[model samples]
Target: MASVRVEALTKRFGDRQVVNKVSFQVADGAFAVMLGPSGSGKTTLLRCIAGLELPDSGSVYIGDVLMDELSPRERDLSMVFQNYSLFPHMSVKANLAFPLVVRHRPRGEVEERVRRTAELLRIEQHLDKRPNQLSGGEQQRVSLGRAIIREPRAFLMDEPLSGLDAPLKLQMRAELKRVQRETKLTTIYVTHDQVEGMGLASVLGVMNEGELIQYDAPAEVYARPRNAFVAGFVGNPPASLLEAEVREENGNLELRGDGFTYRVGEDLARALKGNTDRVIIGVKPEGVKLVRAQRAPNDIDGVLDYTEDFGSTVIAHLRIGQGSISASIPPQEGIGLEAGARVGVRWDAEKLSFFDARSSERIV
Candidate 1:
């Protein structure tokens, strides 16, 4: 397995900059996932790394070699695309053996590698069937089998599980992780699904507007986001962002806004003292609590908007001022709170995140 690296990679189309000076490295034998919304240039970046797209600037490196002039075949990287891309007329065994066959490997060696690859992907039962005869999951496995048969230096997958049904996607996710671990393959996967990124990757890179926003372990990105966009983008329900202004009141830093005035402790005050006066108040769904009265400290009055039951938990949507907040509570705890009901919303002070309003970067 080989490490993959990109340095200040930039790509442009006509007048629009699609990938803007992006840079990151995937360690050897590491499972790295590039996650972002559509048109964020993740797939384009993967193509650049695969030598399929020439960058306008910057460099691509596999292991220790510069790969700018190398063709896709010369790079020795295998790509599993979203569409499966298996030959409809060819049987699974033939498809898996095609790479070695084209390279003029001995027929006996090709058969042996194909057999091993089929067993590794657990698709041995489907080896005699063509792509059209297989289930979606079976075809996905066959696609992976073709890549694994070549024993390439690294693997690139572009939303490989997106086409599968929800349950199949869940099943294939575990299957892919198991196959990767067994082979110890260095892999780069691109997807917009946060669940897939969190589930499969040893390292995760978040992108927005063609820029690499944050790259870290999935848990770290969730717990400590770099800015407001990341804070709002990485979580399930995401952190609620509300506008507020920092005001000095009797040696204290107070966040004052429509229908709310929150005071920060001395330690945070010292940190925000010289910074900007405006900030975006952020609260996670789990940090929110609903109350019948304004008895709790820091409680902000709000109107219940709706509730969603999830068996284990209920998410209560509340409207406080013009901003919305999602509070995760036990079903029993969320009982009686329905739309149009007035409730007091309180956020855990310790878990709150603050971002500069203008820069949208984390202040504390």
Candidate 2:
């Protein structure tokens, strides 16, 4: 296993800069995921690392070796693509053994490695099946087995689980996690799915518009985002952002919007003191509570717009003035609420996040 590092990596297609001055490091034996939306330069960045596409500027290194001049085959890294990239005419065993055969390993060693890889991926039963005969999930296992048999310096995966159904994707993710743990291979995975990125990564790298937004542990990225984009993108249902003005009322700072006013604590006030009057307040869906009875000092009254039931928990969409915000609540607690129902939304001042409206950067 080896560490992978990219420094000031920039790639351009025609006049468009798809990857602009990107830099990050994946520790040896750690699973790192680069996550972003489509056309956000994630796959382009991965291809640059794999030597399939050359970067316009900067460098890629594996372990202590600079790999800028190396060919894809000479890079000692295995790339598992989204399509499974299996040989249509070859059986699972043949597919797994192809890498070793190309490297001109002894016949006995190739057979042994193929068998071990098939067993590890739980595809030993399907070793004789061709790609056409295998299910989507099974074919993906063969793809993974091929990569594993190479015993490459590192692994680069580009949305390897994108083709599977939801349940199958979940199962495959668990299997992939187990394999990575046992092999301890340095892995850089590219995907647009937040759930996949958050679930698989030991280190998470968030990307947007050809820039590296944040690089950190999944929990830290979700809890303490560096900017409004990271705060909005990393969460399920996303964090709700409301436009407000910072006003010093008596001794306390208050955020005043069209239909609501939220008082701020000293810590948050101190953080926002230097900012302009215009600011954005961010609150996660879980932080927004639906209060049925008496309104508190921080409560904001709104009309319940709609509800989405997800068995154990429910998402309540509320309309506060002209803006909309969502609240994640337990079904039991939100059972009495209905569309057009008058409701009060309240959250702790400590849970609120303050951001500069113009820059969209976090102030608190």
Candidate 3:
């Protein structure tokens, strides 16, 4: 279960390049993830894929082998960090039999694979406790049962549940996606959160500052974001960006903004014909929906500016006429919109997205 890749992967520090030419791939057993925000080299690209940091040039395969000539335990791979480093006088069944007793195996097959990985990570009633008697999600399942008792062929992990606490990081993200799909293994997973990389990978790269901007899948990188740093970094009250202009009217391609004009749809107006005036528009906070009046294509009104319930969903914050956005409503129509209230937003010129206000790219 391997398949990682990563060409062009530069990684400097002396002259401050910190990761620049990054590339991506992660197929084999697939769980991928990466994500960003925080010095954003995403733990220096998961410490250069766990050989513990090496890339000054490129290359770091995994299934086909070339892991920069190996070491960090010959790069077979199994990392899991964010600190639950275990061993405080071991005993969660000796920390899952300390990696099958450092690979010597045979103590009755290391107590039958530590009683089947402590009953598949429920931590078998905290196996005889230690590491200060467990619980930070049982010392993160005894550091993921010492990396799933070394079944390693690949699994990297860096922000291993960033020290839990949002209901124990959502119950250790559904018990780490049910023990990575019952040991399918080939992981990767570094994180700067974004709901733990859209609730556990299966492909999503993203990264920033050091670059790798958008690898897709998690609703296609939150619906087709290819630039403007992935349409202002994947969504959730994030993609509003306005600053329109692109005219061409009679042939119909509008956009205009600062009060409102919009149209832009003959296939997004031929993908904004090289921006006749400026572009940017990107809408998505559930694609701007807070309606209760003025409706019939791209409506606009304004001044509601604030309301954030989130008990299921309610995000209003609009100021549309003077251009500012935000609208995720639906907690039964957010109990009839409030704060200053002059509402009427609408949005769906074929779900408008256009970009490139000076190379922020994606005009299609």
Candidate 4:
């Protein structure tokens, strides 16, 4: 296993910059996941590291070797693509053995490596089956085995589970995590799925509009985002961000919105001391409590716009003034919340996040 590092990497296409001065490092034997939306240049950044797309500037390093000029093969990395790029005509055994064979390893050694890899991926019984004959999950396992057989310096997986159904994807996710932990391979995985990224990564890098916005532990990124973009993008329902203005009401600091006003504590006030008057308040769905009765402090009355039940939990959507917000609640608590019903929305002040409206940078 080897650590992967990129320094000020920049990639551009014509007039548009696809990757802008992105820099981060994946420690040896650590799993780093790049999370972003579509068109966020995450895949392009991964391609740059794998030597599939050369960076216009800056440098990439695998262990101690600078790889700016090396070809993909010379990078000593195995890539598992989204489409499971396996040979249709080759059987599973041949596909797994192909990497070692091409390197001119002894036939016995290649067979032994292929056998071990197939067993590790739990596809040993399907060695003779061709790619076309295997199920989607099985085919993905074969692709992983092919990559594992070579035992490359690091693994680059670009949304490898995107082709599978929901249940199959979850199954493969667990399998992939198990394999990576067992081998301790330094793996960089790129995906638009926040759940997948958070579940699999020891370190998470969030990208947006061709820039690396935040890089940290998955929980840290979720709990304390560096900016408003990271705050909105990392959550499941995404944080509900409301535009507000900080005002000195009496002796206490208060955040006033169109239909809500929340008093800020001394700690929060200190964090927002130098910020502009205009601020953004971010509250995750779970942070918004749905109360049937009116409450003091941070409560805002709104009408229940809709509710979505996800078996065990329910999301109660509400319309406060002209803005829409949602609160995640237990199914039982949400049982009486009906559309157009009057409800009280309370913010969890302890979990509230404040951002500078102009710069979108987190202030508290």
Q: Which is better, 3 or 4, measured by lDDT? A: 4
Kindly state the number of residue pairs that clash in model 1: 0
Clashing pairs in 2: none
- Residue 61 CA displacement from its true place in model 3, Å: 11
lDDT of 2 by residue, 191-282 (tens): 99998999999999999999998999999888888888887788778788899999999988998998888888777788888677988888
Question: What digit string (tens of lDDT, one per residue) describes model 4 on residues 1-364?
Answer: 8999999999999988999999999999999999999999998999999999978998999997899989999999999889988998898898888888889999889988987898899998999999999999999999998988889999999999999999999999999999999999999999999989988999999999999999999989989999999988887787888898898878888888888777888988877766689898888899988878657766888899999999888988888888788788999998777789988888888777888999999887
> What are the root-mean-square deviations of the candidates from the true structure over C-alphas?
1.5, 1.3, 13.0, 1.3
- Of models 2 and 3, which has the larger TM-score? 2
Each prediction's whole-model lDDT (CA): 0.89, 0.90, 0.80, 0.90
lDDT of candidate 2 at residue 170, scale 0 to 100: 99
RMSD, candidate 3, Å:
13.0
